[model samples]
Target: MSPARAATSVVDVVAAALRERILDGDLPPGERLVEGALAADHDVARHTVRAALRVLAAERLVVVEPHRGARVAALEAGDVTALYELRTALEVEAAHLALSRHEGRLPPAVHEAAASLAARCRVGDPRWVRVSEAHTDLHAAIVRASGARRIIEAHGALAQETRLFLLRIRPHLGYARLASEHEELVADLERVGPRALRAHLRASAAVLVDQLA
Candidate 1:
């Protein structure tokens, strides 16, 4: 590849790396993103770091100010509420669609995701990031089962934010509680159907929203 292409690839790689860290809670909300520090840490140029930050800013994962530079997006309580409301709506629909298309049986991927989540929660004080990823993966599995590419695309960013929110709420929810919830969720999806799934999602959202308040 040419030099320009190589540079673009590097910027993309750096941006993806930073985005994962932000989503994983390694870089928590409101934490400053120093370009110089990141460039040095990643062994890239300052301008490359700036490009990566811009990418994150566009995704709403980082907020860039005129004078203060970039920081992880500090979602307010209202922001969290709005996100969860949208999430519930889309996920509820996805669950309904999945069940309708698949004869009321969730794809095996959803069950696998549920099992992974349970295993993560069984670990003593599992890292919140791992638990959060597992949670997102389970939901993603359900959405993907809906057989709608656009819905899955729309859910990608929302899932990342949901994972972040889950990390923030993990201390209050506890690992055992989360594990039990997933076990129930899988059972409900396979046996109880979409109504139960919607109720479960709404209740989970309410619990997280309450923590934000």
Candidate 2:
């Protein structure tokens, strides 16, 4: 591989590792990501670590200050609300389009995602990361069902931030409740249309915002 390509690959690996740590709550919000420490930990050059941090910052997973370096990004109450607002708009429209374009039937992947969510929750001791992954998968399936490329791309852009928010509120939203709510939403998407999705998103946003208070 060319030098530049090898360097870019290393940056992606480091960034993905750091991103997982942040989302899994191993690196809590406001925790400083020291470049030197990270470089040593990942056995990469300090410049490589800097490049990885920049990539994560672009994804809104890290906050890079002028001299203070990088820290895991935190979602304030307002940020939670803003994210859910945008999520609701995209997801609800996607639901509507799915119903209209597919003859009022959601694609099979939506059902599959819902089932995976329930299965994750059904584990003896559910891991928050697994539950959050399943939850995000279900929502992504819904958006993909819309068959709109731009809508799918827009929702995909929110995936990392959404997972961060989910990690914050996972304790409040118990696994059972999360599974049941999504199962119902999937059912309602076929029978009742996009309103069910809007209500679900709004209710989830309210819970997150309330917890941040």
Q: Return the top candidate by lDDT.
A: 2
4-90 per-residue lDDT for model 2 (tens digits)? 899899999999899888888899999999999999999999999999999999878899999789999999999998999899889
lDDT for 65 (candidate 2): 97
Question: What TM-score would every model get versus the actual structure?
Answer: 0.88, 0.95
**Which residue segments of model 2 deviate by more than 4 Å?**
none
Worst 10 residues of 1 by lDDT: 163-172
Which stretches of model 1 miss by more than 4 angstroms? none
lDDT score, candidate 2: 0.91
Task: Give lDDT for model 1.
Answer: 0.83
